[model samples]
Target chain A: MLNRIRCLLIKELTQIRRDPRLFGILIMAPIIQLVVMGFATNTDIREIALAIRDNDRSFHSREYIRALAASGYFRVAALPGPVAGDARQLVAGRAGLVLVIPPGFGRQLVRRAPATVQALVDGADSNFGMQGVNYLNQATRLFSARFAREVAVDARLRGLALPAVAAETRVWYNPELTSRYYMVPALMGVLLLVTTMLVSSMALVKEREEGTMEQLIVTPLRPMEIILGKLLPFVVIGFAEVTLALPLMRLIFGVPLRGSVLLLYALSGVFLLTTLGLGLFVSTLVRTQQQAMLIAAFFVMMPFILLSGFIFPVENMPPAFQVVAQFIPLKYYLTIIRGIFLKGVGWHALWRDGLILLAWGVGILSLAALKFHKRLD
Target chain B: MLARAGLAPALPLVTPAPRVWFNPELESARFLVPGLIGMLLMISSVVATALSIVREKERETIEQLMVSPLRSEELVLGKTLPYLLIGLATMALILLLGWQLFGVVVRGSWLLLGLATVLFLFAGLGLGVLISALTRSQQVAFQVAIIASLLPAIILSGLIFPIRNMPLPIQGLSLLVAPRYFIEILRGVILKDTAFVELWPNFAALLALGAAYNLLAAHKMKQGL
Candidate 1:
């Protein structure tokens, strides 16, 4: 049985090696896809366009506008007109935020009286509007503090303490809140699914389409042996992709590998079984490679990426989606990957997700094997 | 089309609330349909055209066509034209459905929308032809089609991720991607009621990319790839 499987593996590898273009694309496509998309997924919304109508046009108002721009979150554009209050920028979609600073302006600030600045946000983009509000709020508080200090100094007063609740936040794991730090590791798991499941699903379909499936079925090898033979090479490819992607991710994107490499490989081995098995199941359902590609992509791959907590937080997903996500092997693998890469925790922290992934591997691999055997018969 | 598109951005309205315009209820469909159109165009144009051409090669029908009186350019046109028309038909259906089912209507000019969709179809079909020319099997074409067109279009096109928020370097690179302009035009027309004057640059870029890609595909077809 082992010998028969080895022959099949060698035959498959030889075919892949012969088609260098496909092999080259197969090797590089997923990594390049991962890197390009992963790098672009900076969820931190920065550089939100702001159209500010500075009513005061005072030194302090200009200083305040400069501070907002310097924070690197908002791009400030000054409107020459008075506080028209109509928010033309928002109406036109040119800017996500609009600010109208009242003329009561510098005098109120010099006396430490209440200073009022009106803000108008475009609600058309919910996420952008929310983030812009948050950043603007923080920037204003900082600017106000600085202005208050200068006023106290000019008056020759020793101390002016404004009572407030200041949040001194210390973020752990990903210190800078860079979305790349969050997405790159999650993308590693997504890459495994794209490379392995789609490749394996298409493998048998390609054979059937080429009229070689019957030839393979007529061979002396058992169906289980053939299944392992087909899936095992991709298992190797999946590992090689991860192995290659790891250092490249580190070098290019500065994605840290905090956990033990050995441990990651161990968990990855378990995850591949689930993906390969899912691919085998997909292969049994398709006639042509095109059908295989579409089904695998739309049905399997899309749902996996969505539910895997890669982009939208799985916790934020509705209860129904959360329930459906429980069955997805990629979901478990993601927790393991993100935990290992970002949190640097070991078996104690990750054992539950690891265990669930292993069970999924065994469950799905058996189910796929049964289906493949039935198809062969 | 050009005059209407050029004249539209000249007028501006004052919103009662800065956050919500046009969409008072904030129906997710209003935000989603434009991106959906962009994604569907990619799948149908790139995947459908590439698959159709590669299927002919796989089934050995291309040899029959090549031996016939048709020139390679005509063959390319014959092959891609149906898909382009079909893509437009599909876009129209989607617009109808979007309005009927989701109440997400196209506020921009229909002529401008049609032109953008046609230009985008050419760009997508060119990519399909290029992939078909490169690969011998449907499997390879399918993989390459997704990687080269669909993935980049979805990610780099500001369909899901806003292009304005991207780092300037990535934003610069995104200019090479055709769907960026298509989706931008779609959103401007569909959601924000943006006029053609505001969107002429995007339309120009789409036309250039479409011509470049189709011309390159023609060159490859003549070379017998």
Candidate 2:
């Protein structure tokens, strides 16, 4: 059985070698994808082109503009006038943010009248735009807080005091809040899903389509051996891809490799097995390569991405969806990968995740083999 | 027997209750816009390449085409044109949906958006042809094509994650991936409204990638399996 598996692996290698194009796609494509995703995934947005229409020529209004500039959030552009409509153009032009401080001539502060600063933000790209909005809101509040502190003795500012205690945010794992810091490790799970499922699904359906599965049914190899023989190469390929990606992440992407490499590998092995098992199950359900690819891409890949807590934290998801995410192998792998990469965590942190992955691997693969055996008989 | 029949639907009750759906438009916008473009490129390129390749193989006209006076470059362009057109149409449909349904405005000029869409379609179709040339049968070609089209382009590209967060090595690696460049180009032109000067590098990269892939595909075709 081991010899036959080796033979099948060699056949796959031969096919890969014979097609340089496909070989490049399989081996070189991920390397390129990693580079592209690295450069583009920036959560720390800078160079916010902000236009301030200062209607009030007062020192207080000037103070706000100075404060905005001092906060490192906005680069102030020349404004012809301060109007809500004018700020809309700045946002529409992708300037990212626009601040309109209304005309009170510093009278509101002296008289204790309620003053307002209107922030118009571009909502087209919500992630960055929302971040920009939050930064802007915080900056404006800081300025107001400082202003309130200065006038506390005047009795005019007593009722309009800002919150006494400021909420200090210290982002623990990703200090820089770089999207790559968050995205790259999670992406390892996604890449594994793509490579493993693509290969196994296509290989199985190709056999069925070519009438080779019938011959396999007549052999004494047993259903488990056949499934294992067909899928083991892809699991190895998935491992190879991940192995290549890790160093690339460490050396090139500047994502620190802190944990035991051996543990990371061991956990990834179990996770890859689970992924391969899922792919085999998908192959059994689909009769053709087209159906296999679609089912795997849509049902498997999409859910894994949405539920993996890669982009949005699972805690932020509805309680029910969070529960559903537990069924996904990628969710566990995401935790293991992120924990190892960011927190430098060990077996103590990831034992349950490892167990879950092992269970999934054994259960899914066993069910798939049993179904294949029953079908053959 | 009646009791067993009544228990048939209840057997599914053995599993825990399913999760309820909370439909949020704001949540959908972040992934949906880029996904629409990426999915369009994938669906059009795979179907077009599969149909065209199957036609050539079934008619046995590939050998005749190889011997014809027309250059392989011309033939590839002819084969790819329909897919490229369909992809552009798909782009238009998605853009319309984004605007009408999702309220995503095209911040950049429509002309630039059109140009970017065409280039992206060109790269996607070229990739489809390359996959088509490599596979033995249409089924395998379609499978490979979908794999190539759907995964890396949608997720690996900067569409979802900002590229800076990828490990430095992966960041460098992404320079060669065609869709990563194209997605940036699309977003720059559409969402960011960046001008030609700002977008020139990405456009050049995509065009270079398209040229390189098409040339390799043509060479492979000439040296038939």
Candidate 3:
């Protein structure tokens, strides 16, 4: 049985080697995608086009505007006039944030009276709008703390705590909160899933389409051996992709892999099992490579990409959709990758994710083998 | 959650009054519908046309058609016209669904929107034909078509992430992607009520891209034959 499997594996590998175009694409596409998408996936809101309508022309108002500009979050472009119309135009055109400091905004702050500043945000993109609001709040609190200290020194009131309570935020794990650090790791999962599924889903169908299945059936190999042999090459290809991508993650993207490399490979082994089984299952259902590719893309790849929490957070999804996401293998892989890459947690924290992935892999591979065996019979 | 936990005590100190402009209610469907329209047109046109051509090749009918008196351009058009109609029909269906299910009414000129949709479909169909001609195998064509169309439409087209926030190089790279312009036209026409005077640049870009793809595919078809 081992000899038969090896002979089949050698045949599969040799055939793959003959198709240099497909082999080259299978290797190069992921690396290029990772680098390109690494630069594109930024969630950190910075350099928001901010149009300021400073009605209170006092020194303090200018100071506030200067402070906002200095925070590196907002590019303060002063509007031609302080009218609501001007601010609205800017927000509509290109500016994401518009700040209107009302009249007497400085005197109220000096006297410790409540001051209201109106912020009109272009909420077409709600995520950016929310992040912009939070950044503004942080900058305002920082400015207010400095103002309170100055007021205490000038007023000769040393012991009194200021009336305003300030909140300080310390972002853990991702201190700079760069999205690439988070997204680059997730890109690995996306790349592996797409490439592996594309390759393996086409595996059996290609044989059937080319009329080679009859020749293979005449060999001494059993159905199980043929299935394993067909899948083994893609598993190797998947691992090769991971090996190629991990260094790109570490060297090119500068993402640190703090967890044991052995553990990551082990988990990746399980993930490859799940994705390849899905591809093999897809192969069994289709007679043509075109059908296999389409079904694998729409039914397998699309749902996995959407619900994997790669782009959209699963928590923010509707409750029913969130429950649906739990069935996706990419969802669990994302948790493991992010935990291992960002938080550097060990198997102690991530063992459950590992176990679920293992169960999924075994269950899916068995189902695929069963289906393929039944098809052969 | 932690940010809110920290801010819970400081809620009384400062009240931030935020008003959203253009989309006052912040309806996601208003934004998602236009992008979805662009995506649907792309998948249906590109994948369908590409697969149709590749299927003919796989079944050994393409050589017979090639040996016929039909010019390569006529052959390309003959193959793509059905998928083009299918693409337009799918676009109309999706637009109708968007209006009915999501309340995303077309605020700008329907003529402009229709023109943009045709131009977008032309580019996508041209790309599909191009992929079909470049690769021999239906599997490779299908994989290439999906990878080429879907990822860029979703990620690089400002459908999910704001293009302005992307790195300058990636932002520049987005200009090469056809759906980026279509998404702009869709959102501008459907949600923002943008006039044609303001949308001429996107129209011109789509036209140029569509012409370029079709011309290249026509050229490649000639070369392949």
Winning model by lDDT: 3
Runs of candidate 2 exceeding 4 Å displacement: A1-28, A57-63, A80-91, A103-115, A144-174, A177-179, A207-220, A253-260, A282-291, A318-324, A343-351, A370-377, B1-61, B64-123, B130-158, B162-225
TM-score of chain A of each: 0.89, 0.83, 0.87
Per-candidate DockQ versus the true complex?
Answer: 0.14, 0.07, 0.32
Q: Write the per-residue lDDT of candidate 3 for residues B60-130, one digit (tens) a residue.
A: 88889889898888877887787778878888898889889888888778899889988998888888888
Best by DockQ: 3
- RMSD for each of the candidates: 8.7, 13.1, 5.1
Better of 1 and 2 by lDDT: 1
Q: In candidate 2 chain B, where is summed lDDT lowest over 10 consecutive residues? A: B11-20
Distance (Å) between predicted and true CA of A237, model 1? 0.9
Candidate 1: where are CA atoms >4 Å away?
A80-88, A102-115, A150-177, B1-33, B85-115, B164-169
- Candidate 2 lDDT at A338 equals 89
Distance from true position, residue A142, model 1, in Å? 3.0
- Each model's lDDT: 0.77, 0.68, 0.80
Which ranges in model 3 have alpha carbons more than 4 Å from their true place?
A: A53-64, A80-92, A100-117, A137-154, A157-178, B1-17, B25-30, B95-106
Q: Write the per-residue lDDT of candidate 2 for residues B53-124, one digit (tens) a residue.
A: 444653477888878787777877888987787778778888888878657677777887787777777777
lDDT of 1 by residue, A255-335 (tens): 888898888999999999889888888888878777777777777876777667766788987899899999888988988
Instruction: Name the weakest run of 10 consecutive residues (lDDT summed) in model 3 chain B.
Output: B6-15
Q: TM-score rank, highest first?
A: 3, 1, 2
